[model samples]
Target: MAEVSNKQVIFKDYISGFPTDADMYITTSTISLKVPEGSKAVLVKNLYLSCDPYMRPRMTYTTDSYVDSFKPGSVIEGYGVAKVLDSGHPNFSKGDLVWGFTSWEEYSLITSTEMLIKIPTTDVPLSYYTGILGMPGLTAYAGFYEICTPKKGEYVYVSAASGAVGQLVGQFAKLLGCYVVGSAGSKEKVDLLKNKFGFDEAFNYKEETDLVACLKRYFPEGIDIYFDNVGGKMLDAVLLNMRVHGRIAACGMISQYNLDKLEGVCNLINIIIKQVRMQGFVITSYYHLYPKYLEMVLPHIKEGKIVYVEDTVEGLESAPQALIGLFSGRNVGKQVVVVARE
Candidate 1:
């Protein structure tokens, strides 16, 4: 190992409204990558980190959010899959592959060993842990199964359907015998959702003049479940077309992430009239159900029933652009960054 340390991405300051790549930047540091002797921490070489929409909230200094914001001047922390190179903790040994919250850098000294879960299977690509097999997958599973509670033959709609979580949610809905439709930002994403991810129907939201009318046309009987990814206008439109007793799983709101003033939905009364139940969630709260999710999803992946899409960036240097692309619908699939290799 080199005596000098490596470069890491740091938050420049507390952001307001929307976040841009300029809000964060990469910097060099000389702090030792390894944990000090006798310290109950493991030193890890980060391989891949996931870029998600939720990370946007963490960039702001907000105490009301589900999680605390990332401190300015410090390395931004997010979900990363890494390989342990050294450890003073008994639970982990050198060479162990794991995934958890790690600083966006080549190496990170992870103090919370409990948060890091051992990679039990190497049969699949290790990078899967940064996406399909990690937090995104779990979020899709929990949101669909636990929140949406779809029944056979029901109608399901997924917004931003070609994304990391949206793709999985669509496939999972199909497996449960539901009529699933999805909306994406472009023709390419629409085709991926329909032809690749096996969604029943998909359309480019950009091409559609009125979202509510689009939903009404596709879902003639109205949507039984709505897996919302892009909030604001899309969500407002969805509420107008939802069937009686419809369930909405509020997975993300990428559409409103960058706006200075949030959009207001004009159809708030629809929720009460239709008995629509909308709920927002954080995946970390459902970590206890991970094994259950894996048991259900792993078989589908192995049997080739489940399909995942990802747009990967090469190094930590490209992470800022990759993450910023989420708000603009620039990323075609799950955005991930390769930080290092074992």
Candidate 2:
């Protein structure tokens, strides 16, 4: 087989603060389409790439973190949807559609088939795998239903509620007959939380100088469940506003990811005062429940009971900017990059 040009997004170095488009560079390299003889690797044509906040932590130089840091001068890796062109694995074959951890490139030779999931249904858009039916979906499902243990008529609050996981968490709360409110960074997202995602109340956090007072106004009875995405001050405020026996599912701390010095939450004593339970989770811990998750969420998606919003950029060249846009709140929904069609 002839060598084909592969366009890739390469990590420049370990970042100290907020990442920029300059932190990653696009370069072209040649690769043979065929897998090596006797290898259990699969060659994939990447379709869509997901830009997630979790990827930010991996950019830093760290050996103690749960996930491995991205190597400098190497192709950046993230979750993506792809089509199998050739496979040496028994579980996958040519023309198979899958979603998994793939490099930010047009094509990739994926050796870690364990991480790859075969796409069973094609009725929905393939890009949905990068957001709704993918990691974000499972994260929201496990974090809310499993961790929060939601009940009907509970008062629920979700931070970063217009983003991928948060949006779903709000909707799920509503589905369970809970009174749900959400917080976002902008007016447009605030509107989305109320009008589109079906939150009972929504607020723009940037507009509120006093977060504690803001939470008081929204949840006068105090929050029974808090789906924490943006931690720090928001968390501190929620700690004060939480009802006795409240549950907090710590999904992501987006507010602290880019900070040079991580902010401390002083109101942690409130957890003990109220006898509240606060738990942090990693999505990979619940991968065994993916089948059950799909069984529940997929039907809701097909029946129009749940909806997903995505902010998509076209081509491999747009990958870096799309990723950097996450920290700045430039994208209103799930950030995705379309690498190829088919």
Candidate 3:
């Protein structure tokens, strides 16, 4: 392996309110792109890093959360696709591409070989691993199939519909013969949902003043399943329009990410009245189903039954803005940062 100065993104401090790029700083250090001899670790050159909403929680050092925050002054870590430059592990050989948690840097030494899954199919773009074929994909799969459990011809609604995970959930529901409607922050995103994703209907939530009324207009029969990505008001609105025995899969809450205080959910009684089942799950908890998720989504992707959209920012230097863009709805699709080329 070659010696190089690794350029990496560092967490400066615990974040508050909406985070700015100033909170993160890029720094460099001298390093060799190889794992030391006799160590069962793999050193990799990172290709793409995924920018996700949950990562905001990780920016703040919180002990109450299921996942720990990124340590201040350390390299920030996230899901990324990388090419192993050198390996001392039996599971991975040199030059193999894999995806897992990795630092936002040019290269990384990964000891958790178990978390890194070798990319079996390279016919698709390698960056797909950052979103559609990685954590976000698994989140969509698990949230839709396992949590919502939709029946054919059921009415389905997804908030933040044009997002990486939300878009997939909408399409999956449509594939299951369900009537799907999605709400996006912008008209462009709403158009993408209807035209590109083949959703039954889509609306710009920003334009809708009465969310409950808007939902009722679209779902006259009531919603059978809700794929919730933006919680708070959206979740409150959906609760009023949910059908009896409906299911809610809480995938994320991008709307609540920047708030100084988490918003309170207003309608708990609706859950009991409608016998609604609302479950919150972390992708890590359902990792055992990843192979099953792969089996289901990979074919759809290969056959063009499913389509993926990504907003790629060139260079690791743009990583800070790309991640912060998620909360502002500035990103049109799955936000990813290109750290280095293969």
For model 1, the stretches where C-alpha displacement exceeds 4 angstroms are: none
**lDDT score for candidate 3 against the true structure:** 0.92
Among residues 3 or more apart in sequence or in different chains, the pairs in candidate 1 whose N, CA or C atoms overlap within 3 Å are none
* Model 1 vs truth, CA RMSD: 1.5
List, residue by residue over 196-315, the lDDT tens digit for candidate 2.
999999999999999999999999999999999989999999999999999999999999999989999999999999999999999989989999989998899999989989999999
Q: What stretches of model 2 exceed 4 Å from their correct place? A: none
Identify the candidate with maximal lDDT: 2
What lDDT is reached at residue 287 by model 2? 89
Q: In model 2, which residue pairs have backbone atoms overlapping below 3 Å?
A: none
Each candidate structure's TM-score, on Cα atoms with residue i matched to residue i, is 0.96, 0.99, 0.98
Query: Which should have the higher TM-score, number 1 or number 2?
Result: 2
Q: Pick the candidate with the highest TM-score.
A: 2
Model 3 spans > 4 angstroms off: none
**Tens digits of per-residue lDDT for model 3, 264-328:** 88987899999999999999988899888889888899999999989999999999999988989
Model 1 CA lDDT for position 219: 98
Backbone collision tally, model 2? 0
| Colliding residue pairs in candidate 3 | none
